[model samples]
Target: MGIDPKTIDWDSLGFNLIETRSMYKATCKKDDSWSPGELIPFGNIELSPAAGVLNYGQGVFEGMKAYRTLKNRIVLFRPEMNAKRISMSTKRLCIPEMDEELFLKAAIEIVKDNVDYIPPYGKGSLYLRPVVWGTGPVLGVKPADEYTFIIFASPVGPYFKGNIKPLHLKVTHNFHRAAPKGIGNAKAIGNYSASLYPSSLAKKTGFDEVIYLNAGNEQLIEEVGSANMFIVKDNVLKTPRLAGSILPGVTRDSVLTLAKEKLDIEVQETDVLLDEVCSADEVFCTGTAVVVTPVGKITSEDGEHSINDGKIGIITHELRSLLLGIQREECEDTLNWLHPID
Candidate 1:
């Protein structure tokens, strides 16, 4: 009549696990020595009402995944990269610098402990979220002295719920996601919270996602809400270079490497004008969750334009399959990007 994830057969792309448990947590003290991190049950967190994160929006986070490889082993895709990015976010938010090795250790432990939740070959994956935030009471406007770092795991399928249709996007020139010297690069909660309203408005208007451009000039593309953008034209891959404005996405980096070495394509990191992208043969977005998603059409106040026959282009699909092959352990990981969990 009913079944649990563990009860299902571990066939290709299926999620079947007997039991799920354990999480990693650590508390940061003002003394700079973090309390010994521990493995605990998956549960709720207790935070102070007046914490800096609540009042002043002082928090940051990162997203990663554990894949079920062909060898039936669990591996994380460049987790150290995510940890390093979190460190950068902390510095930007005035948070304490955490030991990267220790953080990686905790992350690995959490995924290994909850390995059963990892979906079968093509099913899905175990999504890991590492969150760091101000904790304890802090009524002042400055950063909080106390903090908490926690890692949690969940079995997730596709990022978008419905059919795997290429997204229809809207280029927004009015609202901007991040500012020149602001906290846009960081994976801070407030940055996403700020995007909710505008994104919701776009959805109501029939646009799948809103492509937020720079505030000053509507030329440079920053990022989608949860992913970064890329353009493929004449066998050349172009993405917005890391200005202080865009979030440095790990998947974006991976795709660039794959395009150059494996696919024998030229990749460029430069500022691309919105008009220039209109001429591109293909466009796609990349992130840890949505590995590579194509953009079929874009509508702006200026008017709508079709991107490469308004279909998922050949280059986008090829790159996505190659990357997913490595992630799912279906293909050779030549770059040694996957780290196996104990």
Candidate 2:
């Protein structure tokens, strides 16, 4: 057993760890297949001091959420997309790839075991973090002999504290979120480490997050530090094309589909220039954590640009409402994105 639900202040939940009942785990060797994992009680596990993850940073993780819906039911949104993405990350990191079926099964089992930790409907959702790490010792810069896969969770609130109010972001050409020919698209642990300093600096200066430009071309916008970015220009919804450097967010894909089908908006996936984003009619971001949030202000060397007069754009509001409605079972899940836990 873990912390009692009665003690959890659901209304005050944030994106911090609230230890749950158990976590799923599996192991494998470099040349072997992944073992059938089991749910282990939440606690620390021993690891080698010279582990590859500790030394060379060989790890990949995926972020997804489980929601308690309006029908008093538990569900996941587009989990298969997460499964596939994790698989890609593992392969890129040299970790023995785990089967997607096993991944989904393990995810289900972990959530069910920690069901009580899930916040109540409309309060917040349980944040799921599935990670694969190179656990074996490594001396030279090479793949480890063994690996570990774990799926843990926490009860959390909105990623950005201000709620639906638009975000104030800083554009930084000084740092790039990913390399065009590197592990930027793999969700590798190191990719995030590269952004900590810049992101923290931006936050200290009163900005919510920093937007990175493409490594090869500073003229092109890549993505927000931890989320995908989008711009609305002249009624066209546009986002940076996935050119192997940017993360292909599940929420990003869902938003694109919804814009075209539900809202009848033309969508464009291609090169998005820095000038284009700073001058767009509206800007927003999407991820498991942020869901959908508009960019109200963008601060760069040139100056501060206010989007839609520093308010959440109309299109941004509609998209967020439609997506949340489906997540909460309030509207028709026309896309069949939600997978009921039961």
Candidate 3:
């Protein structure tokens, strides 16, 4: 179905997929050389049942967005950072890395082609999902001889939906999102698979998301199901250090930088204990999808502990506003994070 932005109610949109006009695709051969990718119509392609991505889960992906500014310009936030991160993920997965320039080129082309699908400035934004997978059929466990890279976009509303109410999270001790020194830092497909059950359990128990802890001790706070966690105490912002098991999210980094530079807040990347979180003055999470969301309560075996009196902290509100302002071009782009889609 063709997407008509005029007919669609942008305000009612959700974080769901509505395939757009076209996507960009490229393939790599057995000799580890990549072909110049092309923009093609959106559809499924044939793949062998024994494809490496199916059998061995050899794949990596990235999530980003293009926003419509108040001035009617489309811009991407830190596309180069996504390019570099995806390249690193591909390398870790034994897939040939596409050059950063090529990655950006493909992203630009895909967003520009679907420009009309991008919602108006305040309504929503165009979300882009770029994926690379091993496509070659192989019986043995190894990297595929062939690989495919593709990027598709969908217009999505705010991930949390409705009013920006603070969320409630559960600290899950039964499951770990990633192990120590594993592929946790990479945006690999397998990492998310491990989080499904725990996250579902949290939801079933009436929690918004699951907060994962370090695998070994289950004492140190790692991250949430789909975002990075942060805590505030004594006027300082703290998040878990990137210890190879945590995904270094672009939005996480942006928040840290903004807190330090713009807000003049002291930011620390260190081991955040569960006890600290329980007693924190404020808590929040950041990601490409959710942006910045405040955590009002954390429920664990000990019981529920309300953060900042179960209200959004002043810093959380200000940081979210600043980030959104910069994204919509309502504030100065002093960080040079936005890449125009024109």
User: Against the unseen true structure, what C-alpha lDDT does each candidate score?
Assistant: 0.82, 0.91, 0.91
Instruction: Give the lDDT of residue 185 in candidate 2.
Output: 85
Candidate 3 per-residue lDDT, tens place, 215-312, comes to 97677999999799999999899999999999989999999999999999999999999999999999999999989999999998899999998899
Worst 10 residues of 2 by lDDT: 157-166
Q: How many angstroms is residue 43 displaced in model 1 relative to the true structure, after the best TM-score fit?
A: 1.1
| lDDT (C-alpha) at residue 188 in model 1 | 81
- The per-residue C-alpha lDDT of model 1 at residue 22 equals 66
Residue-by-residue lDDT tens digits, candidate 2, 287-336 = 88888989999998899998999999989999999998999999988788
Off by over 4 Å in 2: 160-163
TM-scores across all candidates? 0.93, 0.98, 0.97
Candidate 1, 1-342: lDDT as tens digits = 112457544444322223347678998965485555998887777777898788888889998888887888888999889989888897788777667888899888888777767777666778788888888578767878888888877676656544568888888777899887788888888899989888998999999889989766777777876789999989899998887778899999999999999989999999888887777899999998778999989887778889988888888999998998998888999999999886
For TM-score, candidate 1 versus 3, the one ahead is 3
Per-prediction RMSD in angstroms?
A: 3.2, 1.1, 1.2
